[model samples]
Target: MQLFSTHKLRNIQAQEQAIKKHAILVVDDEVANRKVITSILQYEFIVLEASNGVEAIELVQKHPNPESISMVISDQRMPHMSGVELLSQLAKIIPKSVRIIVSGYTDVESFIGSINKANIYKFIIKPFERADFLWTIERALENFELQQKHDTHLLSLEYIVAERTKELADKNIELEQAYKKLEDISLTDPLTQLKNRRYLDKHIDAKVGLSLKAFQNWQKDTTNPLPHNEQLTFFMLDLDNFKSVNDTYGHEYGDEVLKSIKPLLETLFRSSDIFIRLGGEEFLIVVRDINQTDAQILAERLRKTIKQYVFVVNSYTNFSITCSIGYVQYPYITEQPNALSWQQVVKLTDKALYLAKNNGRDAWVGLSHLNNNINENEITKLLDPDEILTQNNTINLVSNITLTIK
Candidate 1:
């Protein structure tokens, strides 16, 4: 009989080795109960013994990771702490581990609380059936393995999502940089390095908002008498006879002349001023917080500087250039309302530019003189074709004069 029992035990041990060892921690103050439980599970599982809650807590802390501890089995009655208490502490350290309680006392309330709070997986009576105990432990180990697999899958998904998010963010930043580079190329004038007309149209609304805010602030200060000179000015300057330069000296020389004039204009004005190239031979200047006189002075100074600086195209060729300037100040005719619209101011300045071209082509003109002439009939007549120019001159008489001079 001894020889037969030894052979059976050896076969069981060989089968246990073929399967992976599941670790189990048993907590009990009674040495006999702990020995019995260990003996029952030792054949299939690697059993660890803990005499009380303190020892169980230390064991759980020592092997906190789920792969290290498969399950925990504790007795309800102990010296320092109860089974429920030990399970609750273990739940904090290793929440995924399976927990079971073996109790002789039939206190239903505390047992229910333990199930609710500590998430106990199973409960066994003091006198447990051998087959039932073995089946319960096998079931607990299976559940534990399933939970570990689920947790691993969740971790892998989180990692993949994090990596994908970072890649998208980097691509977004690259796209924004590419867009900004294209915008810079579009808004720049290649010859003069100044802002082109497209930039002006895109930002005009923001400029209008700023002007409105300034007008509102000026209106609010009623006690302080505002000066007549505190108003926005718009200056329109055009190069005189620019087409002649391109026709006489080449387009390249004309481009050089335009490039040279930009710096002189920028140096004569304040940094708060905005200067823009509104196409060939035309420029617009927006000077804020300046009165009509200061704007006119600035324009005249720019004109004089250009006239004095004789531009040399190359080693042997040189020429002189001139400019025509027209300006208009806001609040042209102040009414009882004490406010003027920006559109009206721009119209006045445009009219002033037309007058400056008609006056002599190389002087400055202010819109104050044309304020009264901005009536409905005059505006209608100005738009009429018959009032613009006539082309019925005698060419035969001019040819005769030219022949006599020759």
Candidate 2:
């Protein structure tokens, strides 16, 4: 253990000796003062002497590297540009250089002022004790080395932190792209790339909740005049005899037919309109702030457009499809407060869709006629499969009929 301890102590001493070889700059106009300070520091540090402040500044500027000249000790009252003036200039040029001022009793006040301006680290009085002066130099060099090490450590830490932050930012961007891909997969219809029923349900639920809240708030404020026009129309739609096309031509052709129809539907509706493929040949449309007449005209136009639209599978094979539409206008449902729920509005539109299908394969039916039946509780109940539109429309069945309502 003693032998190992001796080896470790020798290694430490060598490392310290290498560090002490780093130089110190001593500036004093008095030759004797410079000699005394140099002799005291030379045993532990490499000492450089300057006869005046100008020479001190020149030596310090020449030694650009901080490790070369660790500290500067100068007399406050020098021939030209005092120690404080040289130090103040040095402070701006090399902020890390530690500065100490040596002064006599007469120059104390001036030294104090210099201390504040140049931020001199320490001061020593003239006629100083040899031990005190030596100790002060040692302490100043020690602090200078410590500060250098601290600055180096901080720079290393900043570099590591900057690298880590960049890595994290890259990871966040990758995650966002992954999330976007997932969202596209979730909401898109694989065949047509249009929004699917699941997306429609989530979006409509939020919109309906907002609309209901707004309506309720407006009702509470009876003193304010009502808006001239306020109504929401739900249009339900279905492709006319879509299964027949699937049966006559293959399912591949049926898929082609659905794909062909999507662009037309998208063109017919405004961007603000919500359109969705509810599955198979069924679709739903939600149009905001439209009157019953406009809603009916819109539904009729869609039905006519689909009927005229031809689906061509091949150069020789051409087929045509029609649509059945049903719509219900809200605020027409009931005059009673909280009279109509969003589900009931949908149910009434579904009922209208049923009537359209019942009347004929390709036609539009309006549910303004059924407005009397809508009450808050019943409208809420319409969301329940059992209480809403008949199972014939609610149940998903592979059949020959096409129906749609918005």
Candidate 3:
């Protein structure tokens, strides 16, 4: 069995050697010159012969394996096409193939530029020695192999870089979406899906500052025929008897009532305005770019809407609720725009809401503006709007209720 296997291996080695032999194509118009070069190379290489450039091109095009034609050797002077012209066309077909040009004359400088254009591997003068010709052919083939390897390695590196870039881009997009989701969760009230105290605290100062700039700009422009009340207005609202809803029904039903307020607020307010649920049944709205008259009108409308709309907890559980509201414009005194800070203004608004609750359950009260000449002590007393407003006539009040002066 060992003797039989050794004989089979020898046959396989011989076949591999024949397959590895280099194929050389020699193109020349003269039959004698073709025979001379073929005789020199035939022992080592598989020499293929072509009479001219056209025949040489046809042979290469018809070859089964393009890489099998390892080298092409052509004479410089030939009919129809010169050696440089033939090699330029072959460069487009099999760029990895080595090319050589043989010239009869020793004028190397004359055709050297054309040889470069054809990407010719070497220029040989005729009557060259057999040893020099063989050396030139071997060197050209080695150079061709090196270039092919370099191109393949560069392509592999480019592919890896492209894949890594795509992966990084995909990861960046995922991180952005996740961060957006977390931010939304942090700023929203889970029960009502309304803006929470954190959201209001984060944005109220900037909103107030921007509104102040707008109010100052309008004041400077005397030609602009708009009222000074065109500014940011804060509204504080409370459900009249919201605790009874939780007492009669469970807290789950009270949550449904809270959720119902989001759609109601959206219907009456502009998208640019801020709305927040300040825990329990109390809510806050920051109305933008409105005068006292329009602000009072909106406050009344919100009260009526809440009184009329039915809160549906389930198939058979339905009830109606009412809200008491109080509103105050920022820069309460137009002459002294920064007379009272926003926090103090909101406290006055809360006092007005208590006045509404005291006079009647479903009502809206507004503090239009404070007197320009009020003393600092009087300004401090403005928080208890009922006694100060009735005694001194220092604050002007607007309301939707009849005889609402508490």
Candidate 4:
């Protein structure tokens, strides 16, 4: 290759003055080749030189902003590190640089192997013409500018997508909360602010399913201890004579008396236990993992609490109220003579409750051994399959569930 001619040299000097503001890096072990590459580009760009991959990496580290250098020209054949390897390292070091590989005819295959990794913009073999060399550099610079624009647009799109995704996720969370609120309102007793029968129809079935499973497990492993606290105690209670309060003092006074009892029930039972207001003047208390005595004690305390507390009728008149409670120990016959489901347990409790009502109210009665009447019909009822309703991945069985005391 020949040096730049006199007129060409003057033209190069003039071109350098008007060159656009961009940098180019040429890496080669041969000083002669570096000089040749630099001479052609020095007129049109800010030229940088590196003898090896190590030196190229050092230069990239020195310049904090790698985008300042736009093009990288690397010779493939080198001692410690090949040209392809150098460009590969430069990619990580300065990703914005458009890479070009300069190699001999024999080493063209070496660049092909790493072209995917190096993102080589052009491949120039040995003994290239000046016009082709200049043309390659010009195109590489143009591609670098186009790449910058693409990255900017891509970043803007990613930001917009991320923001939209977060907004949609937030909206889904709000919708779930609102749905829960509406569900609670539907299951609440308006007058007493207590969970109504709808809540019982679902929660009781889940608890009962657990009870049945435990009972089956106990039967299977009779020698082992009861599995995971399988006991459920139910207390059925009602105001002894709520109708008299309604008739004599009007329904408004009776309504107030029912609402007043909310705090008393909350205090009597545990926070974990579920409490339900069945309707006007009737309530149910559900207790779990308790002994027979503990169940009796809770029932007695509630009965006595109502009997003692003074209920203000009007501003002028104050009177006392009394409640009768009846609770039954679950799995009444643990010896397996009878497979007692929750429905049967409820029937036994209701029977005991009527016994309390029959014995002139204002008291609590526990189920005795005499009431354990296991007939064929009751056994059929216990084994019958309840209609299962699955909601939110939860299995809710709707049974032939009803309670009456007579």
Candidate 5:
């Protein structure tokens, strides 16, 4: 009971009109009967005549289009082939065409049982009324058009379903790709192609959480405690007079200098080491199993490389840049009375970096450790990466051993 839109209705009507344009083929062996049937139908339709079933089939083959010869009317009991036989052939050739049989007998036995076999639309007596004959022809054509419309409607529905399904699939792919891009942007610094501060915050929190859980376990049992042989080194780096570079050469050139250092830093460190940019010319390196001496050696090499390498801003403009670095090596040990968090160590590292900046612009400084008051609650709050990254400046520090990057 579905209704088609106005536009779709117009399309169906147009197709039906093309289908109805074909001539009606009237078959009869008798010359007078053939002329009589043709004459009657000629007023409303283009009528074609065939002497027998074979001739009728030949004419149908010539006009093989579904639109051609929409209906067939024939006299039964012909010389060679009967009306029923001709209609049977037409059924195979043009299945949609309406078939009708005519005869002189009042009680037609051949048609009586052959209606289903020949697929007859209607049958008329030989001495038939002109009104009844015309009415039968009109109804048969209407039946043919209705069948065409129904088939066309089914095909249209299938096409619409296919198109909509494809559209939904395309939208799903787009959504998935967009989600992946957002995930990448969250962890990456867009300018330097290095890990962002957010990634550092998340990573630091995860490490601290495990450490705090161990600290709590140690509190419960004074005998069993977490092992602290693993040491992590932090190289907090600041580009010397970076604001002056941007002011002199423009922000584009400043961005070029930042991007250019990534390969230099990557070559100096292992894959396990994490390189980070904390917005605007400040960078950090976190390496595992490293001491102040080894960390300062790496920082010195990086400073020398940057100072010597000509940063290519453009074909016409090239410049040299330098970075000052300070490192803090923090060690975690089992059963240590007052354990400092890595977050606290990061804060202390920042202070030592400022000392290097104050002494000389391009030198490096290293501190052995910042012995911290172990508060087990420190790890629980480490879940918020933003807070850990933006640590407050008011933390108290008890400092140990020291070194520098040339």
Candidate 6:
């Protein structure tokens, strides 16, 4: 630990003294008793003396700020009103102020009736040691400062909650607009709440057409557009051996496992991207306006996330699941954006998915691009056995299984 200089120590002492500057009220019918308590506390705190419970209340009311009085100490027996009654009324004016009562042994019987009613902090018996009295005052002031700090923190948290609520309301409005577009067609799956295959079948054509148009416009512009932003990428994900889940556990548990994938998909893709449940445990994600490299990174991340996730079926059963992913980018030949039909492109992506499953599960395979020299006939040959394309170097392959493709 480092030691502070004398100058620095003085500054620290000044800050502490500033924080302790709060008024404390002392109430008693006898002038001698009030003087004794005032002399002990006057050096550390702003001490105010009151002749009785009635004068203490009047003094507190006439003060410019009631909150400045951090604590109140009163004798149990007093004229005009009792200590408990005075503190109870002061509670309404300064609810956070710490209250303490000073009473004699004879006054113990009255305390049993009024302790909770006054919300007293602590009791000081008559003929107390000076040291113990000062210690109690220090503790009561600390409690007062803590309550003030807590109220300040609560106000800040309330403001943060209000801001977050407004943001959630705006997101709900966006969802409402999306729901209007789906009004004409029933597109949601009963389980998982992701779009069903029917939604994809109806919209994939328009999606592809729009991507092709954007690519063409990007190519013609003299001012170059960002690289890889024109590609339309798709990911095909299937849980490895998901049927066994239903067999070992019930179908209800399997349904829960499927529902869990919705959030995982949302985590990896943007809201603008389309997600589809192509029946069973297979999911399709269409991500637009992303580069090929970033799309490949997302596919690998999704595979790892599924592998590490713990699927809780019940209190007794918990298991981890893994998935295989295959992805492809549209305009397989960038020069010829429409060289292959959308159906043909999907077929190629499906082939990659099988490749990942065959290589061993919990991995991703991507068909990044095809050779520029390949003709229409050669393209057909590429599919009979995808290995031929890999052998001939007709297409680019990306996978976590190998650093190089054959």
Query: Can you rank all candidates by lDDT, best first?
Result: 3, 6, 4, 2, 5, 1
Q: Please tell me which model should have the higher lDDT, number 3 or number 4.
A: 3
Model 5 Cα displacement at 194 (Å)? 6.8
- The digit string of per-residue lDDT tens for model 1 on 1-406 reads 4446888898987887656478889999999999999989988888889999998888777765644777899998899798988998889887777999998977788778878877999878779888889999998888888888888989988988988898988899999998998897798788897778787677655655565655556667846555444466777788889999999999998999889867887788876666788889888777767665566677678768877889987798788988777677655442211334555566656555555566566766665422322445643443353443111221111110111110
| Residue-level lDDT tens digits of model 6 in 124-159 | 888899999999889888877887889888988998
Expressed as tens digits, the lDDT of each residue in 1-406 for candidate 4 is 9875999988977777657568888999999999999988887788889998899889889987787888889888888998878888888878878898887856545657768778777778888888899998898788778888899889989988988988998999899999899999998888998888888887887766666678777878779875435677888888989899998888988888888888888878778777789877888877877766677667778888889989886699999978877776566655442457666666656656665776678877776333324556645543343411111222111111122233
> Which TM-score value belongs to model 6?
0.52
Q: Candidate 3 lDDT (Cα, whole model)? A: 0.83
Q: Record all residue pairs in model 3 with backbone atoms less than 3 Å apart, i.e. clashing.
A: none
Candidate 1: regions farther than 4 A off = 1-22, 40-46, 63-67, 184-186, 213-224, 227-230, 260-265, 270-272, 308-320, 331-344, 354-362, 369-406
Shift of residue 88 alpha carbon in model 3, Å: 4.0
For model 6, where is the 10-residue window of minimal lDDT?
Answer: 384-393
Residue 209, candidate 6: alpha-carbon lDDT:
80
Clashes of 1: 0
**Least lDDT summed over 10 consecutive residues: which range in candidate 5?**
394-403
Worst 10 residues of 4 by lDDT: 391-400
Model 3 residue runs over 4 Å out of place are: 1-27, 31-51, 54-72, 89-98, 128-135, 201-210, 227-230, 313-317, 330-348, 370-394, 402-406
Q: Which candidate is the best by lDDT?
A: 3
Better of 4 and 6 by TM-score: 4
Better of 3 and 4 by TM-score: 3
* Candidate No. with top TM-score: 3
TM-score of each: 0.74, 0.75, 0.77, 0.73, 0.52, 0.52
Candidate 3: RMSD to truth: 4.9
Model 3: per-residue Cα lDDT at residue 81: 98
Give the lDDT of residue 11 in candidate 5.
Answer: 94
Which of the two, 2 or 6, has more TM-score?
2
lDDT of 3 at 240: 90
